[model samples]
Target chain A: MTMALAGWLSREAAVIAVPVISLAFGCLVGYLAQRSGFCSIGGFRDFFLFRHTRLLKGYAALVIGAFAAFLVFWLATPAAFEHFPWALTSGLSPVPGAPAGLEAAAYIVLAVIGGIGVGIIGVLLGGCPLRQLTMTSEGNLKALFFVIGMAIGSVIFSALVQGWVVSVMKGIAW
Target chain B: MNKEPEERTSARALAKTPVFVGALVGILAAAVQGLLASAGGPEAYGFCVACHTRDLVNSAVNALAGTSLTVAPISKNAVLPFLTIVGVLIGALAAARVNGEFRVKKGSLTSYAWYAAGGVLFMVFALLMGGCPYRVALRVGYIDIVAVIGLAGIVAGIIAGTKIAVACVERGE
Candidate 1:
């Protein structure tokens, strides 16, 4: 396949392939997500407001489905898991608890603190970025606010807050 | 843990229950994302919203800056995810069209601040947490521990944010 595409994009065919493939892949994910009505915010909202969890069950479907898929793929091609960490590579590594001392402390502090804020804000916002993107395309003009907000918030974090978080964590531990 | 049974309120029959659909979505995600990875997309690029959005923001910023800054280096050399987003829009448009749900419903000004704040918070904490809910799932797919830790915080944050939102609503602010 690489050899076949090399005719047009040269060695850069992989680069060209990324966008085309990403679009096609995204189309499938979005279509499925839409049909399944899978969304974190909607799930949480349903749980909180109306005591519904079927959408949240959709989340369960995602986990099991993705997990099985990754496991089989990894078994077939072990090389993929070799480069990255086990988890990213689709191999599970037991992380039962935090590391020892300051590093553990730092990890807990940052992770828990950041997670709380994100979860709450995400619920308040009514969905995450992916859902918002789905909504934007589906004709929710209100979701555009979220798309812009996510970009602005992320830019600020990348340009500013992320550095501060790293420095603070480093100062506290590793 | 038991509450009122959820109604099949949606127009669709399997409306309330995720059942096989969630797994189906997952299968599709894993297959396509894995195939894309084999084709050269980053492994981390598999079903990520937080990372992709941030990368796009940085890329746009870099293009606007016209000069490199001392900020962190996080963007993929190519902006493949933007196309992925476009594909999402297209897919969503098609899906909504098929459902007869492709119409816009304008919201009120009273909810504007809420919406904006929601966006701001989504970005900031997603950055701090290193992933959003879906991205965290991706992290779990990678078995990343930081995501595991952050998941707790996310639940807490949802509670706190919900409380604040409720108070604001009660006060009519």
Candidate 2:
């Protein structure tokens, strides 16, 4: 079912506003993230190694804040969040960002594999994607390379890895 | 004696902390939902690094190369691709410049190669899981069971990564 949000702008205006609003929002996020030196992967690594809560608190607050905001917005605009509390509504099915048309078990497998890879890579690289982006702006050439890799990776995934992974998972039926 | 004043000062400084910044990001993401949901669906998609990067890169590529690569519906339906990453680079650059934190740091060619490789692997895995760490938080907030599982996997991976990091350090390579 397609969602229809009681958005602030009409469809025509919203389409026009998409890039503009996203850019502005990105700026705000980038600015604050730079100031705070925020990194989700670093948070986990620090907490695991040193029992530090400083960065961990940031990550935790993000989850809590998103939950609070989503709840409030969903209540105010039901159509916007037709699947509010996704666990109750969608069950084991994931949000739509991953490969589509997989069973719950396959999704779980993909999530685990993907999550582990992300964590390992992020920790090894010293930050998450947001942190990498900010570091690139800070004139870190290594981070720049990482961001460049991501740009290249995007095309590669859509063109190659995505199809291969989906087919494999479907073939295995796991 | 002076403890109360010190505590108060630190409390005031909390506004500048990562915790506060994270909270702001979370709320603004929801605000994006309220403001732009009419643009398209994909519920908890108000903010994401990996996915949005994919959207921006693929859209630009599609337009330029005339290839029918995929992008998020919001980006596809919009007049242009989502420019969050561009904004991030520009915004962070501005912030760093203003704060006097922008400095050119170089690394060895070998390290650069590793990092570049890491980036490719990272993006691919993040997309496989469907989002980055930030989007995982949002999905968890939105109460997706799979995301919760993904979070667990991240924790497990962190533990494993920490071990590898420690091992590498001890080896002095």
Candidate 3:
């Protein structure tokens, strides 16, 4: 599966390009997010609680926009999207972020577990991670703590939780 | 003159709406993949708050302490870890400062502690699902069924969280 990017950089050059590209894109998204108060979890919460569509529209648009953009890019550069329509090609297998060696059922369970955790925490905290990040920048001390916790959590996750979760799953024959 | 000014202000406000921001994020996510897939991929390797944070921290730890902490292959092969989260911090800070919204709001110690704990737990669960809400959107856009399931789980979680929050409020805690 030979993949090619439409970027001007070659594979060797891409190594250096990664951080630069990612950083620039991140800044743009961050700025927009702060200005817009975008929050995915909040979107769902509002709709469910108050029948408000203002924020919900944003979340729905994100999904639709992503699909439209991916389709366009896939058309323009088919090589870049080896599995353009992931469901058709990969079927039940995921996009490779969970602990590997697990079956589809295990991955589904992880997804549900992770998603529920994220959603509940996000709602209780008043926003999603992006919103917390932006609020931290806006001088919200609570949001700042959340960001700090995430940093600490990341290390702990890599060093401990990841192994523990994988082992536990294996133990359960998942 | 007043009417014209109000109309112009409304136009500006439209640009600041979340719908616009969400669309921008989606398009840019695709752009990231289109431009950077050559570097390496797990595909849908686009915008994700949780995974990117994980990449940044783990990679930094690996460098500073010589620990072999795991990170995404894209971040691992790159000359530097993905700096998206750092960029987000800087960008949001800049936006806040420019808009005169950067106030130093303080919180109680206990509140801070809870937030910090929440952050840790959120990161763990988000990673367990593979990415944050944003990444789930991107993955679903890419037509990943697991992400769809994750989305369903998020909805279920939200319902439960809302119920819990309401209960807490009713108890006057």
What is candidate 3's lDDT per residue for A40-151, written digit by digit as tens? 9999999999999888899989999999999998988877777889999889988888777778888899999999999999999999999999999999999999999999
Candidate rank order under lDDT: 2, 3, 1
Which pairs clash inside model 3?
none
Report the poorest 10 consecutive residues by lDDT, candidate 1 chain B.
B69-78
lDDT tens digits, residues B1-173, model 1? 64445543343445324656566656655554444443343343455666566666666677788734222221243344346566777887788898887788678776665676678777777666555676566555555666666765776776677778788899995
Say which prediction, candidate 1 or candidate 3, comes out ahead on lDDT: 3
Please identify model 3 stretches exceeding 4 Å from their true place: A1-8, B1-11
Q: Who is ahead in lDDT, 2 or 3?
A: 2
lDDT by residue (A43-156, candidate 2, tens digit) is 989999999888889999999999999999888887767788999988899988898888888899989999999998898899999999999999999999999989888989
* lDDT score of residue A137 within candidate 1: 72
The deviation in Å at residue B8 for candidate 1 is: 20
Tens-place lDDT per residue, model 2, B1-173, is 55798786775376459899889889999888778877886778888999999999999999999997769888898898789998999889988998899999999999889888888899899999999999999999999999999989888888899999999999996
* Candidate 1 chain A weakest lDDT stretch, 10 residues: A1-10
lDDT of 1 at B143: 58
Evaluated against the true structure, the overall lDDT of model 1 is 0.61
- Model 2: what is its DockQ? 0.73
Q: Candidate 3 residues B1-173, lDDT tens each?
A: 35788897885586589898888789888888887777777788789999899999988888899998779887888898788998888888988998898999999999999999999999999988899999999999999999999999999999999999999999996
Give the C-alpha miss distance for residue A130 in model 3, angstroms.
0.2
